[model samples]
Target chain A: MGDPGRDEPLAELADDLRRMVVETLCHAQAGHPGGSLSAAEILAALFFSVMRIDPRHPDWEARDRFILSKGHAAPVYYAALARRGFFPEEMLQTYDELDSLLQGHPDMRCPGVDMTSGSLGQGLSVGLGMALGLRLKAIDARVFVVLGDGELQEGQVWEAAMAAPKFGLDSLVAIIDDNQIQLMGDTATIMPVEPIAEKWLAFNWNVLEVDGHDPAAIVAACAAAQAVRGRPTVILAHTVKGKGVSFMENTHKWHSALVTEDLKEKALTELCVREVR
Target chain B: MVEMVAMRDAYGQALVDLGDRDARVVAVDADLASSSKMDLFAEAFPERFFQIGIAEANMTGIAAGLAVMGFIPFTSTFASFATCRAADQIRVSIAQPNLTVVIGGAYGGVLAGKTGKSHQAIEDMAIMRAMPNMTVLAPGDGVEVRKAVFAVADHDGPVYLRMSRDPSPVVFDDSCEFKIGRAVLVREGRDVTVITTGIMLGRAVEAAELLAARGISVHLLHVHTVKPLDVAAVAAAAEKTGLVVTAEEHNIIGGLGGAVAEALGEHRPTPMKRVGVADVYSESAPNDDLLQKYGLTAGHIAQAARSLMERRAAHAQP
Candidate 1:
């Protein structure tokens, strides 16, 4: 993996992707905006700086894969893919539309999508499978997964955690967007998954802690995860529920909600998407 | 008498043959390697086998991942755990995306005689057949099991292979071909049609012989694949006999009975009767005793055939 130098480019792309997430969800009028906004840095960093993907050849065997384990955050994932030229930017508006490939969650039908994931706690296993598949083919490519903090409550995540270490999958990295909020309410009250780092450590995973919104920090965490040997790494990315949007940040209401035109305008203007365009 | 061979035994031999033939054929088990008959494959290719202990959900997830990695992973376990326990993992990761994974659910239906009702998967066929991309197969005997296993490996998509614990009497010879979704015409008769799947085939064959002795000609159709139901053949059977009877070692509500009823209801418009456990949790009994208690024996099937014929004849008079 290269240094992925120039965190400035990733930061710039993160802002653009955040705008896209807001705009796409607003156009759809329904989606998980909170988690989407929270995962902006992770998606931008992976697509723009980290993952080995070619827009022209999405099915290239040598390409590294990224699975959105917290699949409700499709808006953010789609925005990153579109901006990375996997498909035309115009297709983002057709999200959740009738018969649109832009499903409410990540679908493999779209270009650059590795595995179709939306169900919580399943992606880490899928990514691990792909990583192993790549290895069998003598391809040195790795798998990167982005999961939600609330999703960690699922038991299969730990099952995957247990298997990855035994298999010695250093090329697999799972980053958790620990936004501390879920659909119903805050995670601490709903399901206290605190002592999270130690929980992963107990499962024999190499854990990395980082501020999820920091582009440079996210890049470094990914690199650190790759450098490790004989085990899988899970980066615990602490983040605000709704990182960029002022009204939604750290609140449970925006875990998923209909984006009114007025709220859309405010979010877009704040992100300065018009200036970038 | 024809030889009695367990479907799982056939599956074990099939997996060994597959292991030798295919490089990518890998087996993953949830501590049921020996029971599910995957021990044969494991012994052949130790490195290709992954014994994940007793975690069905993890086994399923890992199999799906291995499938993506370019390995044709055959995950095996008890039918109940494979269908109900790890259902979501199989549905979301494997079914929705149409992953090419073959899941062998051993001791399917009521074949696990003494393991209690929970181990018997009466609702498994219904559960798996409900999934969009799943190909549900419950072969009649060892002959069909060997053929079905290789067929599923070549066929693309999510397939659930249901195998029984006890040795079902051989109903077909090697000359009999097995094809997914195509109902085989076991014995052609003119009076009434007996449709069955899995272990019920042996009982149905016996029932047909019994009916033949009574001067009642019976049309028998063995449906190995439950899902992608062969509605055309069922309709033809319904049209020919004007009456249908379905049998299985499962609940009558959603297994072979339900599939045949649904098909004849829509296409053929024939009167049908279901013969199986009457929607109750089966008890731990000897396999033969359980069959007799559950109204799934050869005698019960013969009785169902006679009763359906009497009903049809009486209705004609009225």
Candidate 2:
């Protein structure tokens, strides 16, 4: 299982995801572009290569669970879910529209969404519950929860952090998208969650750091997490706020922005150029 | 004809029974294990029990996590801390997803004498009832509490069980059955109805006996589950008596009074009076004195019933 050569091709999947994010946000005309783009690679790797889930049976009892804790980045999760065949790819256009299953936030009512998680700092707790639930039932399924760097500011997250190791929830893994930018401004300026790895380690979690763009490294961290016992794992994936798009990258303004015709064209061109590589 | 038992002791005994039968049944407490009777569970199954040091929010969140993992978690803490401190977590984490997390709010209402207003949870029912997918129960006595413990454990989803601190007299016999969303008529009468819940039910029974001597027949309805309130029974009692009196050892603004009013207002609009603490913070006093001062005793309920009867009689005249 540790054979690095066995890893699937993630670049192609990331390219497809980049295209989906651009197309969905363009079609919907609304979404959090910066955060969604920043976390695209991590989402791609989890859905395509790591998580053990069946697209055909969304509620499979033994299937692994994934929670998008930073629900603002739902466009990325929706794109991955659609590509995995959880729903019709056409539903991507309905993002944030009234009565549409696809809202700005991830809703559990949607087929592949494990929990409703637009509210920050809550998805971790929900994921922890699912992990504990699996342990009690003697199920082998693991729980993977994605958290934004900004979401770590909430006190509830720390509260949950203290409990994970104490309960010996080794089946749980939290991946933080450390983009260094929040809604207000740079995360360091708004509320510094500096020394991210140290904080999780202090809380007794087995912390792993990786480059957000490197799918191989992300998969390796997940594997390392699975190898451990007793303590839960936290993979601190360092990322740029908006990775693919030149204009949006590292800009907090794009954390959530309208997709104008010009902006959409520029984003699509950048993604298309990357897919060609 | 219903026998009574304290809900707190029943909760402890039921937890021990659940732990014995199912390994997935885990008990988590915020340092009130002895008072809530969770000591029996802890001693019986050390591995399954967790003492989560005075952190109510963390306890609730952890229980939510345990439930999601397929563990049946019963979280015990003082009523005020359980409901007020961790309300947001309860609403979002547990109730929202409809997890099987049983919250035992021991020492509910004025029963926590000497501890005063800070410890007493007068608004727990109101706070929990507001959330969707939550089942709220306040058992009448020790026997009903035990039955309620077993019943809630068997049921799925989120449940808030409010229990008393002090030991109340056993009012229910072993033969008396308990079911969620059902009300039991402790004593039947037609002249007036006294609908009560929790420890206050005992006082309401006493009030009924006293009213019988005064030639005013009193009907006693013990409402165990407060949220899915036995509306039909309350409506039936109201239709028969044309007068209703609600009693509870909680704030008059919510709790039993609010539930009874909400039910009766929709179905049978009868002349009603509520016997509970009148929206004021309680001062430190002995448990009995506190109950009497807060208008939560038999005499207060009887007086409220009499007033409702008087109002009904006035309306009956041409």
Candidate 3:
């Protein structure tokens, strides 16, 4: 409806994020790769095309807020923030280092981070608070929260899901990274969260299932979320666990494994090939 | 003995006042609205109040959402559920982001009486105090509770306001002003300094008066706000009298006693005695009987103070 072609810049942004994620993980030598790589496209689209935010003024009163509920995917978020000029891109290398602002998880102490998150199932609630706070202040800023599919096992997430619509937090958007693999193993083998979209709808949210890798579809779904007026929106993004990396893709082992030099090079080559195409 | 008022009642009255002053202030309760005395707020501002059912975690998460949206949300429930059931959410979701969420944990310690240990929140102070950027307040009475509520509203960041479910006597009058991180010296003495918080402050006040009649002048410092502790006041009181006695209605391990010891251990080391529930689950009994059984009464505090004085005298003689 709005502009189907608005997704043109998203693909480039996602590619850029993938490269950044790989580079940062290589530099940090200790970070989550699988989930971060899986979430790059979604983060890129949300930051570059979907959300209305100002990089210069990270705490702008009227700016939209994004909460990475699955905080282990900090690499992608840090990449997007650095790219957006929220901080120096060079600082991305110091992620998880002592006294580094780029913490292993998103810390609110860092600029551009609306709420400190990483402990799963909690971010949506905090994002809900921010969205509600904006509405109470009569500020027209929307809140977008990204949650992991595996993290849904946390009972608190369901609690937040039930509450969002009750408050009429229409400005709140929850994006679930429905990556099949979790930390232990396949999510189905560990704890199944199938029928995800139906669950969200049951909780009174406006549910939309989309191809997470398809930047165009994500942008469109996000636009639909913005257009909705009463209930909160949930985008059940169907994504691969280790999206970009050839060896890492669709594997739970890479969820948070250290990226060896060989693995890094291989991952970079795969991302580059994806970029060139 | 001085009259006392329960801090929970003050919280309810303050909620009503806050709702009247600011429309953005809302109360969310998980089926404890009436018990927490939030019915008045709900009755007055039906539109602003939210009955969140029996979901403590959900209530906390929703409150975080409400706070983020620029509304001051006060979530009420039993201390056990408020802290234990939703501790992670409170820590990461609210405190980490530094949202303006006030968690009113009623029925802390043996205040739940017949409900027994399952409902008691002996570990709440420890859990909340461990959190970063959290303001932990344990107001002494109704007047102090009002001050603490207002103080929390003014102070930015997350706050855990521990209140009592039982009806406590009114200690402070309307003239009392609550200041964050400042310990109020209710009863001043010279022999020993007694630092007390929560409902136990009333007991400490009575103990201090009793000690005064027996020529033992005991200084009573009511520490309403636990975290962002009144270090200077506590240190100053400890400095004046080398003997210190800390009293609270919680476990001695991580509650007010432990907090005081930790502070005094770093600042000015003094011979101290802690008056609180020892490490043991409370059994079913009447409120007064439970207080006596758990060593949370005025008599227990006075006895602990006397023993500390004796120990101080013995150390001085040697």
Candidate 4:
């Protein structure tokens, strides 16, 4: 499909995003790298290709909004923002340090973070609010919320899902990163969320399915979400827990584990070699 | 005597006025719009009103999101649900970020005892006050509620407005100045200073008159803002009278009594007594009966004041 990531225009940006995530995690030595690695292509697609944002004016009222619902994946989010010029890329080295703007979770003080989010099952509802606010003010903009598959276990997510469609918030889009793994175990073993697309469809949402690692497919799904009207859209993005690094992929150990220097070097080499191939 | 009105009605009217004055002011409710008195604003600005059904946590997060977009969102629901059910949401979403959202907590205190313990919020103030960057307000009457709403709307950060369900005595007129973090001196005396907040202000006023008739003049202070308490006013009152009594419709453990005790214990350390619901669950009953059962009426406050003053006199003679 689309030359297996070679034809994707934002492929280089996605690769850079993954490298930054791994480096940031290795520097912090304490962060959730699995979800961050899994969400690289999605974050890259949104920040680099989909969102209509100006890095110079992070708080611009008219800019399209993006919220990291699965906020433990802050590494990927920070990488995309830094690459998009929301802040200096060099500042990525200070991630999770004392008094650093880059907190373990997404914070409003950061340059391009639309909403301060870390608690799961919260971003979709917040996005619904921003979408409603935009509609009331007559400001034309869309609100995007990225959710983790494991995060669906929280009941609040369903509450928001039941509300967005009722309000007819066509401008709100939720891209669920279905990594299928959680902190302690697999998502299905922890809490079965299969029939995920059917669940959203039952909630009256315009549902779409895509390969989360494919930036082109994710971009196309986002475009399809915009074409929808009178109902919110949700893209069920199938993904691997750790998409790039071979040892970390499909494993829950990397959900939040220390990244040793050796592992970091190995991970960087693998990511770099894939581009050349 | 002033006309009596429920504090919730004043809150509803304030929302309507705010909606008219500031287009950026929006309202969010959790299916209790009529009970929380947010229906007035909803009826006026139907477009700005967001009904989130019975989901308090989602409602709180939505309000936080709206605040992030530079909109002043007022989220309303029962005090018990708003503070307890969605406690974490308020802490992480609104307080940590310091957003400008006004949270209206209706049916506060044991006066809402008719709804049983599940609905009463005797610890709402304690929960809200413990949160950083939260401005807690328990306006004494309808007029104070109106003024406090307007004041908090103009305020730059998050606020929790605790209101009562039923109508109570009208304590102040439109001229009474209401400012956040400021305490109001209702009357002046050199005897025991009776400090009160929320619906207990009316009872405190009556208690002062009862003490005055018995040859003991009372200094009454209405502390509407529970957090960021007016320590200066409380200290001043205690210094003048040398005896203090704090009354409230909430649990004495962490409500107005607890707040006043903390203030005086750290600053003044004067002889004092707390008149409130003794740390116990309240039962559903008629308003006056429940108040009497919980030792929250005017007679109870006066008795507490008299006993504290007499105890001091006994020790003085010894």
Best by DockQ: 4
After superposing candidate 1, which stretches have Cα over 4 Å from the reference? A1-8, A273-277
Off by over 4 Å in 3: A1-8, A227-229, B1-4, B312-318
Across residues A35-151, which tens digit of lDDT does each residue of candidate 1 receive?
999998988888887788888898988988889999999999999888888888899989999888899988888888878888898998888777777766778888998999899
lDDT digits (tens) for residues B22-83 of candidate 1:
88888889999889889999998987888777778888987888887678989999999999
lDDT of 2 by residue, B52-97 (tens): 6767877887788778666888998998899999898798778877
Total backbone collisions, model 4: 0
C-alpha lDDT of all candidate models, in order: 0.88, 0.85, 0.85, 0.91
Candidate 4 lDDT over A31-132, as tens digits, reads 998999999889988887888888878888899999999999999999988888778888999899999999999898999888888988888888988888
RMSD of each: 2.4, 3.2, 3.0, 2.7
Put the candidates in TM-score order, highest first.
4, 1, 3, 2
Candidate 2, residue B299: the lDDT equals 93
- TM-score for the first chain in candidate 4 comes to 0.96
Alpha carbon lDDT at A255, candidate 2: 91
lDDT of 3 by residue, B48-162 (tens): 7777778888788878877766788999899889999999889777887788889989888887858878998888998999999998899888888887877777788899999
lDDT of 2 at B279: 90
Question: DockQ score for model 1, please?
Answer: 0.67
C-alpha positional error of residue A12 in candidate 4 after TM-score superposition, expressed in Å:
2.5
Best by lDDT: 4
Say which candidate scores most in TM-score.
4
Among incorrect, acceptable, medium and high, the docking class of model 3 is medium
